[model samples]
Target: MPEIVYAYLDVNYWHPWKIFGSISSVKQLELCLPSSKEYPVGTVFHNLVYLMLCTCETEWLNLLLCLLRDSPKLKFLRFEQYHPIRPSEERPCWSEPSSVPECVVSSLETLEWVKYEGGEEEKEAVAFILRNARCLKKATISAASTDPVKKLEMLKELSFLSRCSGTCHLTFD
Candidate 1:
């Protein structure tokens, strides 16, 4: 069998049984969840630098966050969802407020969001990243409702990123 250095799995029948430890050399991984169950967590890609998750469930989001917290070498992350945010009265709480792992912001260079609908949670997510992610060189958000003016407003609200130059591009489709 050819050594699988990198793997990207969508909603397919392929079962994730075993990943080679040699695959620790894997640098990128993408996973899309077709159901609500948690993904296998035992397989560790030590060299993983890029990870993309397109999942609708909160569990998957939590799993991705946990992985990011554990993977010190992770540098890039892209998360997408197909559904609009459902309004809820209560805000979700993190387990550890103070110990919330700070992402390796200096190492991250790019962030991309596709089909995003700006909501309270989504806004909070972006704010958290912008506040902590200091080394991001490029950020792209593509969605139907994300107007250029709104994006500019968001940029203005980011007090931590006062040095960001160049106007962020916005496209409507």
Candidate 2:
């Protein structure tokens, strides 16, 4: 089979079949499983490099962390929450885990997030990236708020990009 360069799956149709094996040479995979329970382990995508997950739930996030622990070739990572609508009266939490898989935070060269809600967990994740990902060349964070102060803070924290051999960019709208 040809090396799978990309794979996108909806959450409802996700199944633990040999699809991963069919793409043993895959270099990039993007999953949007809205209801995925667990990611299969030992399913080697030897040539896999880039990974993106969208509209993922908390459990899926856990599975992703586990996958990154094993996938060393991965270089680029992007995550975006897929909430259908902003809460009318309640604000939800957007915290990430205290510890992220070292393989991901340390190896990624580029990281991007859209609609990131600021929280302690999220802060820790960004901190991990800033501290461990020495090779990170660029980072982009987009949020729905247009507040200048909030935007400045994100930029300041991510200003560590200056230390990198490349540049980091942040945007808010």
Candidate 3:
């Protein structure tokens, strides 16, 4: 009946048996995906402005990176986890002749992390995003806990990580 400008995809719910449309109009998306053995291929996002991704594991973040690669028009990215996982997940390791995704190299403008626990994998992901997202304007990282010492540590660590954007602004909360 009307154009859709926003979409939410949560795996914890029932979805239409068959759904398809001119989602070309969608500019924002909120996605909550659970950890699993299988990962979906291909996506419908195009010309998006913002995306908030919630997952239970760091492994799922690769999917987000790939999605962002495809959604070259995306501007802002947000990360949230439904559960705090062990700091065991490894950093992104490409197989061969690896290079940063074009979206990270050019399109991304801002990134924010909510409930960031400063896990190794999380830190690596943040560092990777910062180092590659050449056009990034700002990055905000909020820890799960409000402990002043821990927050300060995380802030120092993330702020110190080199970013490709000369004007990137980093803040912690």
Candidate 4:
């Protein structure tokens, strides 16, 4: 798998590292993941530049942070919901990382979130990236809600957050 440069894995398997460990050299990847308690600590994606994740899990922030920490050369990050999520009794959990990721501080340039619900966890994850991505050139957030009132509310809330990149353009889609 060292020769693999791109991979799209939509498997139901929850152990993402087992899949990722085989293809550490991939430059672009798209995958659907369920949250796992343990992160891929030793794996480093030295050549990865673009990543797209399906936000179908309730607790995906940990995995996202872990990937950001490891993908030092990542430039484009995107999140999209591949399937409708049923309401769950538990809300998604999110906790700020102790240190900012190298990708967000230096290499990341573009961000896009589709089917973005204005949930606390979602907002925090998006805000964290926007606040810290110093090289970010654009951020496009497409709200999941169709109602105008809800969209406006989300717009107002997200618009107020300070961005690390002075020239970054933010858009609602």
RMSD of 4: 1.3
lDDT against the true structure, each candidate:
0.55, 0.60, 0.72, 0.88
Whole-model lDDT, candidate 4? 0.88
Model 2 Cα shift for residue 139 (angstroms): 1.5
User: Which tens-of-lDDT digit does each residue in 1-173 have in candidate 2?
Assistant: 78457776545554654465676677887766544354556776556678776633544545566556656777787777764533442322344556655555556777777776564545555655655666677767776457878877766665543333334443433
Task: In model 1, state the lDDT of residue 146.
Answer: 58
- Runs off by more than 4 Å, candidate 4: none
Q: Candidate 3 on 1-173: residue-level lDDT in tens?
A: 13677887766433321232345457887777544234434544666788888856444666676567657688889988765555676544322216676677878898999998786768888888888888999999889978999988888888889988899999888
Q: What's the lDDT for candidate 2? A: 0.60
Model 4, residue 151: C-alpha shift (Å): 0.7
- The sequence of per-residue lDDT tens digits that candidate 1 reaches over residues 1-173 is 23455677665443443433335466787776443344455555567788787745444546566566655567777877754434552333334334434454546556677765554555566556555565666666655455788755654543334322233232222
After superposition, the stretches of candidate 1 with alpha carbons farther than 4 Å from their true spots are 1-3, 11-25, 34-43, 82-97, 100-103, 146-173
Most lDDT-accurate candidate: 4
Give the TM-scores of the predictions, in the order they appear. Answer: 0.63, 0.69, 0.79, 0.94
> Which has the better TM-score: candidate 1, or candidate 4?
4
- Identify the candidate with maximal TM-score: 4
Assess candidate 1 and give its lDDT.
0.55
What is the TM-score (0 to 1) of candidate 4? 0.94
To one decimal, what is the Cα RMSD in angstroms of model 3 from the true structure? 4.0
